[model samples]
Target: MMEFKRKALAIAVMVATSTLTACGGSSSSSDPDPVTPENKAPTAVTLTANTVEENAMGVEVGTLAATDADSGDTHTFTTDNASFVIDGTTLSLAADASFDFEKMASVDVDVTVTDNGGLSHTETLTINVTDLLDYYDFVSEFDAEKSSVSYSGQTARHALIAELKNYIGNGGLQSDVDNGELSSKEEIVAKLNSFYDRDENAWDGFAVTFTDAKQKFFSEISSYKSLKDKVAGNDASGQHALWNGESNEAGQYTGENIAFTGWSTWDDAPAHVPADGVIPQKTPHGLVQQFFSQIADNAMENPGGKRYIHGAEQIEANEIPVFVNYDGTDLNQLIQKFLLMAVTYSQATDDYLDENKGLATDNTGRDKGEKDYTKLEHQFDEGFGYFGAARNYLDYSDNEIAGKVKTEEDGRADWNGKHDTDGDGEIDLFSEFNFGASVNAAKRDRGSEVQTDFTKEAMDAFLAGRKLINDAAGTELTTEQMAELLEYRDAAVLTWEKAIAATVVHYINDLRGDLDKLKAGADDYSFTDLAKHFSEMKGFALGLQFNPYSKITDEQFVEINTLFKDAPVTELSEIDEYQSDLVKARDILQAALEFDADNVENW
Candidate 1:
């Protein structure tokens, strides 16, 4: 009996030890620390479109999955939209109509997932649905169409005539041929070269100046009743005098007032240009601020500004109602996306401004109350740091990926088969994807208003600060102060990035709401109807394999495959290879996100 009791005691001890091990306790003195429950939610929570094929109900549809950092906890998924379902790790739609799936057009949903410990993480999802030509295919078609149009040669003569007129109006060609600015052919060529080689903004300013002057001359003709009658004939003089021959007039006329300047460049030309010269004399680097100013003015003007005036007018003239057939989706979703990108960029600019303030000025032994060191520190933070964050956000979209391909100042595409930025054989995202028939045209293209606006503001502010510093003469910060400034700026950048990430997450949650609506009515859900209704989500209507957030690289695939091997339902062949590249991108982004999260100086 004593021996039996000893055996029973040994069994009980073994059982207790096994239970402790299961609970993640150390078994020996040198064993690692026990797994402590973290109060913090996932550091990088993400939702990605995993599949667009038919679900178990056999309807063609889209699918998304959510992941958390704490792998062991039970998580609950809920959405702002009605009809969403959560069945363990899977969330599926159960809508009741054949049109239900089609009805699910574009929708933004807020998604909140609470772990077993009650810690919650929130994200936003935007889903858009539409049937447009593939972006890459459309780019090819548009380029081809443009080429064919160019080759027709009908507009070649007109183009040359217009160029000559512009040259005369812009003062590119000597208005007074006897004016001795040029003494030889070489001198003329050099002068011409300078005119041709003028920076982008300078060229734009000159063209604008000439165009404005020409408009003023026509306005003057219209204002004079006597001159109007004289120039009313369909003769060369009438065309020259800003009258397009609406009436027949005197038989003889001469082209005298065809080209005339109303005032000096200062009064009519863009701010960057000078009164004496047709082109703006500012440096190439200074053009961005001038561009911003011009854009701002245009936006404020009721007639539309120079920046997007042409684009807006075209849209109004060719407006095609996108949501006429969509009852389940909101068409304004695309507009909202534009607003979101714009607002985010705006906020980023503000953050950059605040961070870069006083970076360029003299702080050495200034007046007692002067904000010396902080100013310079803030400038550094706002300039480089702020821009870095904005760049990452731009990279998230495929625009920058292809921006390299479009930019050719030095005559080389970024994807010339030699420099693999992604080290993948193919030129990744932006290079491959185009807006095609997508509703969100700006998102797919780099150098968009959203990006351009913030970049200009940030750069302008930085330059202003730089001038201040230069003006400060020899005044400088101490070594310690310099180091501190660097640290502060670095921290500020991380904070801005985190804020941007949060905003992006919010949009993703909005998308989840649409999913919920479909799931709520799953019983009668018709995938076709849901898709039809979700037309507003066309921009967000990503295929499972090509989600924007999942910028995959090669290395990440191997890591995730190793980690998720123990999960149920043994289908690795299909998804594993497909997601490998995405995994790499996600891993890099995740690291960056976490780093930013930890740098709490901005808070």
Candidate 2:
């Protein structure tokens, strides 16, 4: 039993036990000397009823009462157990104490009732926690203003990816750097690095910016905790990477000893300047490092190179910025989506949600280290952050989330009263904006006429799971509760994966349309467009291997990758075969995922 704050402290005083006074003439002067009344102790204490519903904080458990012989005695109630406290005769749950019937069915508290006479009586109060099954009612953190759920690191990384993608594809920056508007080659490289590199874990220095009516997103991190040391898995040290070989959970690797062995099928295929070599990476973090350098070195070597590399660019008809390495793959698209999939999706579904990576049995009923959120809460919250939905994600329509909403519809993806939960006038990217998979889910959902509910399903599961964690406050969950948590997690993961697959199919459709335009000798036929579409298609296809729970088999996976050329299909002679291959690959995804034919074609 622990002492609570409301209980009074006892003070010791030396009383004159025997009144020594000159009372020699008392009997002669008065009938008797005034006598003090004897103090009587409280006889017994009882609790009116000791039961409270689960999920209540600081609610009354019962009424504490005492019986005493003296009519003038007023009693003060105190409890030794910190789980409860007494005010007057009412015994209520402690401020930090939340009872979960699933965790603890009952608790015994020792309560002492002290009378004004300085006499006390103690009794054991048994409290029974009643069950509540409304964990599904757990609201969004944004609606609840859950300060404890901190995962700004994930949101910051999402913003960084967006910023970096924008920077590399900027047509103005391309001509300026290539035409000497920027000072030196080293300066260009420095600028590229600055987007991802910042003050040691402070995660600052990106040029990317966003604004709603109320506030601006400057990649703020003052709201986050321990993750400040390291948030994104973009650095080589992170366990996440584009998985290169077979998907094997038991044989995870992250050190120098492993060799980059598996581009086995396309090992001999021609690349613009192969980025291959057994470059000390089996899992491909080293491959990412290689790309990080390759593009920068390409720009540094060629004073007037295209944004990402030194090459004669296949400019797009729409003139959208195209940043690609010499091999014609957009490093921006690949890296951004890669990190989104491997780091964010993998973390939400595979790493944090599972008992293996974290979210252990002991994760509940306490704060995670010095952070305000409990371990279980933080674990899922981090995953949700990486999913990159605004706190009120469901409020926005699909086109609004994809940033493709027309002006007439009054879509509220950006800063508007609809999503400005903070009401600071600007859309706070940390919580009020959508990014990464959440946006992609919206895109895939709206791209096809057959409509999917990927975003809503996943968001609902995340909310419900966190509710489960909340209900079990300050106590480890029972086996049943943990199972329930995992079930919700699985729902979110499955929907998220389906969105990714649909996205792959969506990109494939884009590539096919590009091929058709090229064959028609359409003026808008742009290799840059084809390259962009192909990169997204192949990149997401590559993503299929990252999720540990993915159903994409090795054979189906290899067949899809094998169909994708070393680069986008640039040669006109190959258009027919390449387009055929595109349908084949798309068919494989459609069959494996059981996507509707009309939806795949439309998507």
Candidate 3:
């Protein structure tokens, strides 16, 4: 029986073994079937929105993060906006991306994080751009009231022209000219003074008499009393005004009204209206009539044309003929001369005297006594008017007036270089009329307080000098204070004269360069081209004659004129003949002006 059981168990065991062997044989030598795990989607990512200032560089908005329950899952990041860039799980503004608060205040970006398994989560990011000017502290320090003074000179100019017109229309000028009693500008001017002194009656053709016009003009000149009062208290109006004043000394108020002194002192005076015993190409009477006629005609022709030349294309001859100084000085040159004198000379000179003499200490003794407007203060404000800048000249962000402060080369209201659009080395009359103002502004701006900004240095210097006078208005200045003030004035004068000298040097170099180009076989030569250069040279030479306080002597003036004669040198080969003469003239000017070549180049 045991033998039979053993045999059965063995048979069972054999059967079990045979079953295992058969299963193993079916699977061969391979491992058991692997269990299949369920796939899980990645968790949605939550990214924080970021805020950055405008013009922020390389700022990271946020890092994209995600969780995947399934192992070995990889993730990628992206953004919908081109300005946003994605790398791995991180997101940031693109390298070259920039923002302008003026243009766009903020930007919103949508970001996405995608897992290797194709699951994605998106979040919107917000970027806020802030204005740079808003945080700037200097904006508040800028004096807008002081800046508004820049237009006062223009007002004075218009008033002077009106006065001249009034004098002419009253028939004083006509009667004098027709009777040959006013054979020269000096005689005409003297006769006009008699009319002013007598309060001449208006003729049948006139709207106003000379006395009425003088009153109106003086009113305009006195309108700056408010600005002047802000700095000091000494009446600078009446005869002491830059256009009407007469004094044996530069800054002294003689209380004598030298009628139309501004017109008589102008460099173009002899040309526009001949002085005593001299002949004029165009009489002041004729010029004034022509000026008014042209203006009336232009208004009828191009009714919408701008009154001033702002760019190259706007420099048409008859449109704004007063903006140029060539072919001898025009009415505009007369106006500019007055404006410049008001700023750099009249006001500047008076301020120096006030500092040295303490004229404002006893305002009761001066003309228009015990007034709120001091001579020093009025002079300073008068300067602003002639500068032709807006009240916010320092606010470069102010698009309306910022151009006034910008450099000529950068194309900001630069009527000077703009008229030279052809690169022919010669500038139009527009440039000639506008060049001195621009050059003066540049010289004045180099001393601005703003490090990164262009401001009027000359204007600032004037303001500073005025402030010194104003501070000492009620008090007598000590000898030390006087010396200090005089020193300041002297420094300013040096800078101004240097600036003018530098401009002369630049004109010389331009002429020299053009000649060099001609000698080098440039093909752009023509009779007109040579004439244009000669004209420019002559125009600049004429300017040298009017250097502030006559720094350019008679000999220097004669030498310059002789060197740059108006001869019709149409031949290109003949340009070289003038080279040595030009160099000699240049060297003479440099020596006379004490201009260092390196320093002049900087100007």
Candidate with top lDDT is 2
Which segments of model 1 are wrong by more than 4 Å?
1-475, 509-513, 519-588, 595-603
All-Cα superposition RMSD per candidate:
29.4, 19.7, 14.2
lDDT of each residue in 206-291, candidate 2, tens digit only:
23443232224343443322211232232223244433332234433323343222233222222322233322333444444444
Q: Could you give me the TM-score of model 3 versus the true structure?
A: 0.41
TM-score of each: 0.21, 0.64, 0.41
Please report how far candidate 3 places residue 123 from its true position, in Å: 27
Q: Which candidate achieves the best TM-score against the true structure?
A: 2
As for lDDT, the candidate ahead, 1 or 3, is: 3
Model 2's number of clashes is 11
TM-score of 1: 0.21
After superposing candidate 3 on the true structure, give the runs of residues whose Cα lies further than 4 Å from its correct spot.
Answer: 1-155, 158-371, 383-457, 514-558, 565-574, 592-603
Per-residue lDDT tens digits for candidate 1, residues 5-41, read 9999999999998988798766554776569766657
Estimate candidate 1's RMSD in Å.
29.4
lDDT for each of the candidates?
Answer: 0.32, 0.65, 0.44
Cand. 1 Cα-lDDT:
0.32
